[model samples]
Target: MQQTCVIGAALASCLAAGTALAQDDATLAAVEARGVLACGVNAGLAGFATVDSNGVWSGFEVEFCRALAAAILGDPALVDFHALPADGRYRELVSDDVDVIARGGAWSIGPDVRRGLDLAAVSYFDQTGFLLPVELGVSSPKELDGARICLVDDMATGPALDDYFHAAGIAWQPVAATGDSEARSLYLAGDCDAYARPAAELSAVRATFETPLAHVIVSDGSSRVPSGPVVREGDDSWANVVRWTFNALLAGEELGITSANVREMAATPSSNPEVNRLLGTEGEIGAMLGLPQDWAVDALAAGGNYGEIFERNIGENTPIGLARGLNALWAKGGLQYAAPFR
Candidate 1:
């Protein structure tokens, strides 16, 4: 009787382990069966992700989605873009409505690590600041005493700005708007003395305003914000899939490889083993991610490298006309660095 009981217990334990393994496989398979990756994006952030006249999506965030699609399904077009409002982003992601949220999310301990979500990678680094007329003569954000500042309702920016103002001993009027666009209009139309937003966003909006000389970004030393991708908590598999996609682009750029030149470089194998591994002349890294062996190639082919994507979307010739100040490749003295593929 004792021997029979021991055999039965061992059998049950083995069965439980098998069940857990099967459940994990089933979850991943279910996601793949959906055919398209649903990505949550900001409703309308110009340089980030926004729908256009013909209802086509384009922008920096859109490219990230496209790249993920290409890496996973070998088709860059296999993405369903969900333009979720800022207030709804968390709900949408937490409810399993989307696979990932590609919005311009800043990493914070409270919302990122503590709120049951994982931040993938910092794709675009930004700073928080205010845009006011040059006439305000406010060289520092601390000088905006009793000045009305426009901020979007239900966003972290308000609290952050308020904290800054409070600490600096400045009493600023808080004017809340329904959305960022509305807040921008309110400030640009002279409804408020200044408008506060992420620095990159301010640059994008400034390009659209007719009165370029009318606005100036208030330089506050405390607005440095890191923007990245996010996935649901405990989903390490999916998180790695998204994180390394951004890293791959940075890696490609640092290695002096571009989409235009990848094909030619692939043919004549490099003596550089690391380049060979990255170009997939030597490793099954993509297969390990449940993608084709040349997945990174497809990602680069869809866009270019990290530098190309930046230049095409927000660089000097683009409407945003942003200079690569802190975003330059590491070798070029910028902060963009990636782990070795090997």
Candidate 2:
């Protein structure tokens, strides 16, 4: 069954500092009424989102939808995953076809206020990069001059490629594909000399190749594309729920909470006051959002923490093999820092 996005923040001043969450969370109400979360995710980005032959969904973004289901519905399996295409994703979100959009699109400017969508916490810190077959011998993107490149017809990627190529004074023919999977097919069939997109995406497709080592990815780290879930603008009450759910994942990692241990941790409050507050063993944090007191517990227990989700879905051990490079905790010097639970 299809539901619609009605939830839809910020840090400190942007969240309006001490503004009160709305007394009635319309989005949450709608979700509860439907009994499932309608999440729109990438249709073919392997590690970010994917579907098995049995039609079961699993991936980094899939876990996020599940975690949200656990938080609001008390069941991780209650979510309905909607595979969205790049061209029409925002239209689907805006039309209320999906409750929230969970994809690789950046929560960047222009997309936010212009589209009346509010971007949530950063789920993955990504950049625009390149993938070239080993036979191409193009160690750097600059090395490819007048190369035919397979480009995905997405919002950020084409402009990024155009700007980079123009700046480097190199001209290339583009082999356009509608989506990632199509682009991968174009690359494998030698339709283009290289393919360009987020490096993590390239790695995911590369891993599925018959000979993974036959390709090399070239990246200048020239773009900062931090991605997260998105919802319609103006629903502070529901927005806070999404914001804090992501925060719970990050804070759980910082506080040493895990899916295997979240129940145990919630069984008895630790001496740490923050953990107690986050886990609802000592505060009305959930009540403030008009949710059950065990909200964070269920969210954390659904898919462990941000780190755990990363490692399990797209981390170094997986075929996607994405490192925690810019996504590490703030304490450890990366950009991922959760706002205080207090």
lDDT of each: 0.78, 0.84
Poorest stretch of ten by lDDT in candidate 1: 21-30
- Candidate 2 per-residue lDDT, tens place, 11-118, comes to 544344334344236688899999999999988677888898998899999999999999999999999999988655687888888888876475567778688888
Tell me the deviation in Å of residue 223 in model 1: 2.3
Model 1 alpha-carbon drift over 4 Å, by segment: 1-31
TM-score of each: 0.88, 0.89
Query: What does the lDDT come to for candidate 2?
Result: 0.84
- Report the number of the highest-TM-score candidate: 2
Candidate 1: TM-score? 0.88
* Candidate 2 residue pairs in clash (backbone atoms < 3 Å): 4-99, 5-99
For 96-161, candidate 1 gives per-residue lDDT tens digits of 888888854556676775678878888877777788889878888888889998887766677788
